[model samples]
Target: MNSETWQNLLHLESRDIVSNWFEKIHNRKLSARRAKEIISSARQGREYFRSASTASFAVRPLLAFYGVASLCRSLTLLHRWDAGEEGLKQGHGLETVAWSATLSGDLHLALASIYKLRIRTCGGLFSDLVTVTNSRTVWHVYDRAVPMPVDNKKQKLGQELCFLDILERLPDIGNTVSGGGNQKWIRLDDFIYSSEFGAEISVHGTPDHPVCIEYADAGFDLSKRNDPYNSSAEITVLKADENLFRKYLPQLIDTRVIRTMGGQPSPHLVSKFPQGSWFSQISITYMVSFIIGMLARYFPTHWSALMGGEKGDAIWPQINAAQMYIETALPELILEIVGNSIFDNKEL
Candidate 1:
C-alpha cells in the first residue's frame, strides 16, 4: 500500500527480482508461447513504470498511465491468454465525452469544473481489462452517509460520469476530492469465524469513518454494539443464524482475502464497503491517470494554466495528489494483480 512495502515486491531497478516473478508465472504451467507473451508484456509495463519515476510532474501522468495500460495488458494476457495476441490488441476502450470550459475568473467555479470533464467506455483494451477482471463501472454514491451499491439492473456500459465522481470514491485522494474530508477506506484488522460461536470482527477506524458491515444481500449494518464503537474499540460481535451463516460464510471469506507483497496470504478483518459495487481500485487509478495524461498531452495550455497557477489554485492540490498517488500506487496494484493471478488467489 505504501512505497516501502510495495518496493519489496516490485523492484524495477533490479532485473533479478523481476525475473524471480517471471519464473513464478512460468511455473504456472502455461504454454511456452503464452508464458513468453505474458513475460514480454509485463517487462514492457515495468519499463514504462520505471521510466515514469524520473519524469517531471508535467509529463509523469502520461508515462504512468501508459505504464498502467501496459501492465493491464500483461494481466489480460495472463487471465485471458486464450484471447491470443490479436484479441488482446484491442485499443484503449475509453473515450472522453466532453470537456467544459470553466475559466470565468472564479476559483470555486474552476475547481468545480473537474466534474464537467466526462468519459465513457467504448470497446477496446480497457474494456477487455474490465471483462477479464469481472468488474463493471457503477454509480457508487453515499446514501445517508452510507455507501450504496447500484443494482446490476442499473449497471450499464458507456456510463458517463464526471471526474469528481470517480475521484471522491478513491480512498487515496478522498480527502482532496473537492476538499471534502471523508474516509473511503478504513483499516480491517481481523474477522473471526466460528461454526459454533458465529462471527466477530475487529475493525479499527475513527468514529467518523463509514465502517459498516453488509451481508446476506442486505444493506449496511452498523454492528450490534452495546456501546458505540470507535477507534479505541477493537472488536464488534455479529450474530447470525446457522442457516444464513453457512450460506454467506464462504462468500465473506472469499471476498476479504488479501495477499501481501510477500508469500504469506491473509484475510482482511474488515470488508471495504463490504459487498458494495464500486469501481475496482485499478480502474479508478487508470481512468484518473488517463484524464491527467490527456490534459498534459492534448491540452497543454490548460495543463500549464493549472500547473503554473494561472488558474485553479483550489483544484491544483487534488490534481497534484492524484498524480503523486498514481505514481506510487499503480505498480503496487499491477504487481498485486499479477501475484494474485499467477502467484496466488487473493484479490483487490
Candidate 2:
C-alpha cells in the first residue's frame, strides 16, 4: 500500500476504534475478583516500598527491588487477558497481541510508579516502551498486508522491512527527520551503549551505526541538576517520528544486539555478596564507597574554604589519615543522603 493509504488506515480514527474495541473485549474478560486481586497485589507492593523507604539504608534496596518485581508480575497478569483465544479468533496472533498488551501494561505501571515516586526520571524507560510498541504495531500491519512465508528467516526479514517502510513515512506526521528540530532523536543502541551501566554490556553498533529504533525527546542529559525533576519535560514521539523510525527497525531486532540490550543484569551477579543475601546491601555499600571516594578526592579544598583558611602543614598528615578512615567507614550520614537522593527518587 502507498504511504497515503497506510496513513489513512492507521489514522487517529482507526486507532481509536480499534483501541476501544480491544478495551471492551479485554474488560469483559476481567472478573471483579480478578481485578480486586490485581489491585490488592499492587497496593501491597507499593506499601512494601513505602515502608522500606523508612528502613535502614542497607535494607531499602532489597525492598525496592522486590517491590519492582512484584509490580511487574501484577502487570503481566493484567495483560494476560489480551492473549486469550478470543483475540486469536479475532485475527490477531497470540504473540503479537500479547506483546502489545504487555508493552501497554508496562507503560501504565511505569507512569504510575513515576508519579508515586515523585521523581520525574524514567523518561528514557517511557520512551523505550513507545518505540517498541510503535515498531511492533507497524510490523503487525505489514505482516497482515503481505503473504505468509514458509521460511522463518524470510518472515522475520519481511517484517523488519515492513517496519522500516513505515518509519520512512514518519516525517509526514510532523517528525523532524532531517534538520535538527526541537526534538532530539537518539538511537536506542546509542542511548543504551553509552549509558554508565549499559557500557559494560558487550553490544555491537557504534554511535554512528546505531540500531534503527529511535526515541524522540529522550532527555538523555542527566548531568543537568534540574532536568531530572522537571515534570514539565515529558517524553513523547510525534506521529511523524513514529513513521520515520521504521528505517532502523531491522537492525534493532538483530539477535546479537537484542541479546545484549535485553535487560539490566542484576548487580548481584557480579558482587561478592553471598547467594540469596540481600542484593541492595551490596548496592548501598558500593554507593557509599563511591560517595566517600568522591568526597575524599574533592572535599579538602571545600573544607578549607569553610574553615576560612587552609590547614597548616603540621596538620596535613592527620587530616589525610582522617579522610582515609572516613572513606573506609562510609559513615551512615552520607549513606542516608545518597540513598534518599538517588534510590528513593527524592530531590538532591
Candidate 3:
C-alpha cells in the first residue's frame, strides 16, 4: 500500500467500507487516534476474511485482503502454544469456522465468524464438533485453471477439469497432508494418519499410528519409523505460547513480513487420526447445483445452446460460453490476493 492509500484507509468513516477503493479514493487526514482506529479496524477486517467460511465473501477485496494476516495469525498461535510435556493441542480450523460463519453469513455478519475463527486459531475459542491441527497448512480447496505462479516460468494451467465433478469441495472440513509425498489429490473422506500432537474427531494432534503412504509415488512405505510423524526430523514450531499470541494474531491485512518465534524441541508425544478430514459447512454448493439443475428441469428452455449448436440455432451460445468464463475468473480473483502474500520479490 502507498502512503496516499494509507492516509485514506486510516480515515475511514465506517467499519464496513464499501468496495470502492479502486475508484473513490483521495488525499485525506484525520486525528491521530482516529488514524490508529482505522489501522486497527483494517487489520480486524482483514483477519476476518482469511478464515471466513464462505468463498462468497472472501472474493471481496476488503475481506480477501486479510488472507495473509489470518494465515500469519494462525501460524503465530501454532508456534506459541506448542510446548511442554503435555504436547501441542490441535486447533479447530475450517470445519468449525463454517458453522459459526454460516449463522453470521445469513445476516451478512461473516465478520463475527471470522473473529470467532481467529479465537479458535489461538485456542481462545473452540468447537465441540471437531479436533484441530497442530501444524496448519493453508489449503486452497480449488481445482483446474488455478492462477499460475507469478514467478514460476510456467503460466499455463496444466490440467483441464470440472471441479465439482472431479473432487468434492469440502467447505467446512479440515485435512492435513503432512509427511510429504506426491499425492495428487484423492478422495479423503475416510483415510487416516497420526501425529505427536493431540488427536480426536475435532482436535489437533499427532496420530497414534504414524503409518504414511504416498499415493502419488509408485512405491512408498506405509510404516512408522519415529514414534511420531516427523519426530526424528528437525521440525520447528513457530508460535508456542497462547498468552503471547493474543498480542499479534489480529493484525491488519497490510503487507508485512510478520513471523512468529521458533527454536524449540522436546520429546515426542503421540496423537491419533480416526479419519483424514471432516466437514461442517452444510454442502450448499450441492444445493446450488441442484436448484440450478431443477430450474433447467422445470423451466426447460434453450437447450439449443448445447455445444456445437452454432450449426443449428445460435440461441444462447454466448451465455453458455460465460459458464466457461466464470470457471476461470473465480480462481484468479482469489489468487491475486493470496499471491500477494506468497511473493516478496516486489516491494515489501
Best by TM-score: 1
Deviating ranges (above 4 Å) for candidate 2: 1-27, 82-244, 247-348
For residues 233-252, could you state the per-residue lDDT of candidate 3 as single tens digits?
32211221223222111110
lDDT of 2 at 155: 18
Cα lDDT for residue 261, candidate 3? 30
Residue 4 lDDT in model 2? 38
Per lDDT, the best of the predicted structures is 1
Tens digit per residue, CA lDDT, model 2, 40-159: 544554565465447543344345434433332333333345432222222101011122232233333422221111111122212221221222111111112111111112111101
Which pairs clash in model 2? 164-246, 167-243, 167-244, 167-246, 170-240, 170-243, 170-244, 212-248
Ranking by lDDT: 1, 2, 3
All candidates: CA RMSD (Å): 8.1, 23.2, 21.0
CA-lDDT, candidates in order: 0.54, 0.26, 0.23
* TM-score for all models, in order of appearance: 0.66, 0.25, 0.21
